[model samples]
Target: MAEAPSWFGEVERAAWDRFRAEIPWLTEADRVLVEVASTLRARLATDPAMSVNAIAQLRMCLSAMGATPADRSRVDIPQNDDDPLTCYFN
Candidate 1:
């Protein structure tokens, strides 16, 4: 286990709040999702080159937290691109 990133707590919480506020239909518990996402993100930051399968698994966890591809909610994804990715609201 490694230390949680200094930015993760703030970034994750902000995303969670925005998601819940916008979707209002994510019946999944907040703590659970955040914890899971934190683990994946920490892993990503440490060694993003981790197996494609592993990366996909983490992606699945993240995708599960939001809407489908059609609904885009503007968000700051930090590292994916220079700009923040738009998260679609399900």
Candidate 2:
């Protein structure tokens, strides 16, 4: 895996951590989306010149990952929390 961009500061780090914590089902495939979302979030916070398209893309990415409340129900969380191997069975 690549290191996070040098521009990633407290805000980006916090967003990354929050995403990982909130979206426990994320796997290697989701890494790129997570990184993009984090970057977009930081840009939105710090860049007054950020484009509307970037903001929309960030919202779409968040919704796709079920990171937003409205999209939470779309995520199918595994019920077998006690067994790490349950993923294989499911």
Candidate 3:
């Protein structure tokens, strides 16, 4: 796997901060969801041309974390405009 871009960590940190602010009752599960999102964000940043998984583990994890559709919309990972998976993840 390629190393994350020079600004990738900053992006991830910003996303995590946003997520923390949006979620009202934080849990261990929430932390896990953020971590999964961070990883996926890094992967996509490293390879924007990567194929999109129809039923991605990230989506499943979000669901398992009890994230609502509104939460999904609010707590987003940083995404490239060119990545097809961007809409799905966010």
Against the true structure, whose lDDT is highest?
2
* Per-candidate TM-score against the hidden true structure: 0.43, 0.67, 0.46
**Residue 54 of model 2: what lDDT?**
97
User: Which regions in candidate 2 have their CA more than 4 angstroms from the true location?
Assistant: 1-10, 79-90
Tens digits of per-residue lDDT, candidate 1, 1-90, equal: 223335556655555555455445555444566556656655666675778887787667666665445333543322333344445421
- Per-candidate local distance difference test: 0.54, 0.81, 0.56
On the 0 to 100 scale, the lDDT of residue 75 in model 3 is 55
Task: Rank by TM-score, highest first.
Answer: 2, 3, 1
For model 2, residues 1-90, the per-residue Cα lDDT tens digits are 234456678889877777777777777678889889988888887899999999999999999888788898888875646988878986
lDDT digits (tens) for residues 24-64 of candidate 3: 44555456566666566555556666566813765665565
Off by over 4 Å in 1: 1-28, 67-90
Q: After superposition, how far is residue 81 of candidate 2 from its true place, in Å?
A: 3.5
Clashing pairs in 2: none
